[model samples]
Target: MPQVGSAHGGEPGLLTRVVEKVFRFVRLAEFEILFVLFFLIAFILFKDLMSRPQYNSIFVKKPDLDDRWP
Candidate 1:
């Protein structure tokens, strides 16, 4: 009797091994990954929101005043 799949007997395929390694890495760095992603998404959203015309009104321009005092 011979194996039907994979040259290495019943071992997992290349993609399966790569996926497993990625999953393991993600599991170990889950918190760090989530934290980075959260900040990244927030930054992107903030940048997008600030680019809108409505947010520009939030900053009021100060009028120029004379430097001399009475």
Candidate 2:
């Protein structure tokens, strides 16, 4: 078996290298590209969160209508 931590082994495959290159290119792009990506994602998540109604306890029974003192 090849020795651990050797250059002959543990190298990323071609597809991985290509993906890394793509990520690097995007990372190196102008600030506008990153800003647009961030804003789009943030806007989508914020909209989704806002659209959901708050949860209510269905199992718990409401206090009796009578207003007797505790």
Candidate 3:
């Protein structure tokens, strides 16, 4: 059987290397990453709010019954 810490025979596996690189990148670009995430979340929320009729009642005029029929 292989040793617990020697699963890859003392070499880092592909997944281990990828995870380490991701962590290192995140640590280096923490502020930029947070800003992007914040912007994306805010944009999604704004879009969702605008899509709801109740939220945009003041901005949009209600169609009359005659307009719908014609």
Candidate 4:
């Protein structure tokens, strides 16, 4: 493995070194990047979730398919 934080030329210890590489690539602070990335993925996922319109149980059901036409 190419050691972490090598790109920034810092003599950071293990934790700081990992944080440096992650911040470089992910564009967020070490403490916040995980939440940011998680929300980003969840946003993309829930974007697709928005169109799911639940109807009355006795009413006509819409064509629910895996293919998205939008």
Task: Give one clash count per candidate, in the order shown.
Answer: 0, 0, 0, 0
Model 4 lDDT at residue 65: 86
Instruction: Judge candidate 4 against the unseen true structure and give its global Cα lDDT, from 0 to 1.
Output: 0.70
Give lDDT tens digits, candidate 3, residues 1-70.
6778776688999998999999999999999999999999999999998999888997988788777574
* CA-lDDT, candidates in order: 0.87, 0.77, 0.91, 0.70
TM-score of 2: 0.37
Which run of 10 residues does model 1 get worst, by summed lDDT?
A: 61-70
Best by lDDT: 3
Candidate 3's TM-score: 0.64
- lDDT (tens digit, per residue) of candidate 1 on 18-38: 999999999999999999999
Better of 1 and 4 by TM-score: 1
Return whichever of 3 and 4 wins on lDDT: 3
Candidate 4 lDDT, 1-70, residue by residue in tens: 5677575565667887798787697674655778788999999987666645553433555676886883
Stretches off by above 4 angstroms in model 3 are: 1-9, 61-70
Report how far residue 12 has shifted in candidate 2, in Å: 28
Model 4 root mean square deviation, Cα atoms: 12.6
Per-model TM against the reference:
0.70, 0.37, 0.64, 0.32
**lDDT of model 2 at residue 69?**
59
> What digit string (tens of lDDT, one per residue) describes model 2 on residues 1-70?
8877556488887888999999898788869797899999999988786666552234345677786955
